[model samples]
Target: MTLRSEFGREGNVWLMPGGSLLSAALAAALVVVGWDVVQLASEEALARAAKEIGPTGRLVLIADTQGRLPDPRAALAGRPRPFVVAVGAGGAFSTLADVVERRVAAAVLDADRPFADLVAALDSLLRSTPVAHDANRLVARLRQREDEARRFFGLTPREQHVLGALIAGRSAAEIAVANQVSMPTVRSHIRAVLTKLGVSSQLAAVALAHRSCREPTLLERMREVHQL
Candidate 1:
């Protein structure tokens, strides 16, 4: 039988029985399969957690290598209105110091942590009174600002549509094409929007528009039509 040596500690090689070689190969294969199973299970757990959390929130895994989180104002702009939770090691948390300072919805330390711990943390965050209060206050303020903006700008229906496109970061040319209008007409509408909003630049106009264009709640709509 051919003898094979297994490398161990420095300058140490142990000779194994020829039968043991086959066993070793089987063990290696088992280890690889076990690792793959663990990875798949982790992914599935995270997926289930995300699904349970629903679209109203998100969990962001932060790492030391991650440079910076996007501005929440810009990042949280659209529908589903998800709250953000940051999870990572202490060093990772330090990297997101600014985000923490801004009081993100939640933060959980992840170094050597269990997956269950993360889900529990998320659940706790969702149940926290302070988090709910802050969210409600934010929504109320956004609605108030939207009301003020609509009243102050006094934009016509066409101008409102143009403004929406502009806020979506559409270029004048793209807006023209999308609206099936000439470049000159688009530019004219853009200028009119800027003038009405009292902003000189497109960026400023877009910024102001974003500050004001939240989807109106039913109560807000009722108030708008004076039915409330």
Candidate 2:
């Protein structure tokens, strides 16, 4: 991603893709609300920025959707910055539910709404509390749960990848294509994951993976933004 805009300020508000009119409008709205905006244009730029931001100052990222940008949660890893995800009304619950469970995004907003609504949400989030503190605690717990699950399952790297694909709703054929492997090889990996996870079906395996983390903490400052 390329940096499309910048302002001399301690805090930063990042827009994943700033070229679109909607993103531009949101960036302007954030600036109006006293947030110095850094608009990222592409996935590369987003990835670069995610790694470059240090663990100081206030940082908030606004992503149109999880799919449009790189995994900020993974990229930020130990940094634990706050994220605002804009998802469609129909898919908001499912998407935000996953975000909450993964501790990826601190807030969710309706993409169908006007930019003003998002600005209002951000304003509330910025004023409530320090989101990074809660986010860091939540993420640390998530990591522990994930590590425990990995150890208990004893899944190899390939098997873990297969399980992740299953959780993502990828068909065996799609997984094979993505991994550049034969259908039979992909099936073998799937079988290995199922065996290690002690599940009879892919759905069961996915459910078990989701069950690994119980009671993931939602960022306190964003409780009023989007209810899942």
Candidate 3:
């Protein structure tokens, strides 16, 4: 029989050239348990990766030093069980430390390093954690949160922009300058964001926004993959 028939369509479960069949199974098991690597170069790529992996998987995201990274909480909002490892330049890590701390499982900031260093970090992380249990419970909780966030904080484009800036810890004056608006206009947008998200202060608004936006779940990802 040919390799295609032996392994089924897409060949995801098949052994690679010069690799053992057992190693393939082990890799598949890691994916199922939500331990995988995602390399990102832009916000769009990060979003795509997040959608593919879902929430329960452990992700080691290697970001290229080019574009802005997505807000980790928003990028991971749809996931039911979220664990992330962010790898990037030192400046990137420092700039995003708060979000990283809140959202990612770990962060490795070594901009000048080679790709081998990233692989080593991922290996160490996988060996540290046991397999996750109680996926169903986590999924249910995630679904509830998703519903609530969508209902309460479904923001407009402008609001989303404002929210993004707020989460990045920009001041009202800075937001005004960046968006080419008056400080009063920025404050108004901030108030609107707070009202829509049902929060009291700018910090609370940022926190709510972080917790609300996320990519698709694993089941959703599977459906997309199968359809493709």
User: Which structure among the candidates has the greatest lDDT?
Assistant: 2
Clashes of each: 0, 2, 7
Please provide, for model 2 over 1-228, each residue's C-alpha lDDT reduced to its tens digit, 9 standing for 90 to 100. Answer: 223334434256666566666667777766666667777766567657765555442344344544342246555656536545533231233444456556556655444333467678766665555454464455455455455345324776677667666666789999999989999999999888777766789888766655451211211112222332
lDDT at 110, model 2: 42
lDDT of 1 by residue, 85-157 (tens): 4433322323344455555534433322333444455345534432443444543453455454564347666
lDDT of 3: 0.48
The model with the greatest TM-score is: 2
Candidate 1 root-mean-square deviation in Å = 20.5
Q: In model 2, how large is the Cα lDDT of residue 219?
A: 17
What count of clashes does model 2 give?
Answer: 2
Candidate 2 C-alpha error for residue 103, in Å: 1.5
Go through the candidates in order and give each one's C-alpha lDDT: 0.44, 0.56, 0.48
TM-score for each model: 0.31, 0.44, 0.37
Candidate 3 deviant stretches above 4 angstroms: 1-140, 151-153, 215-228
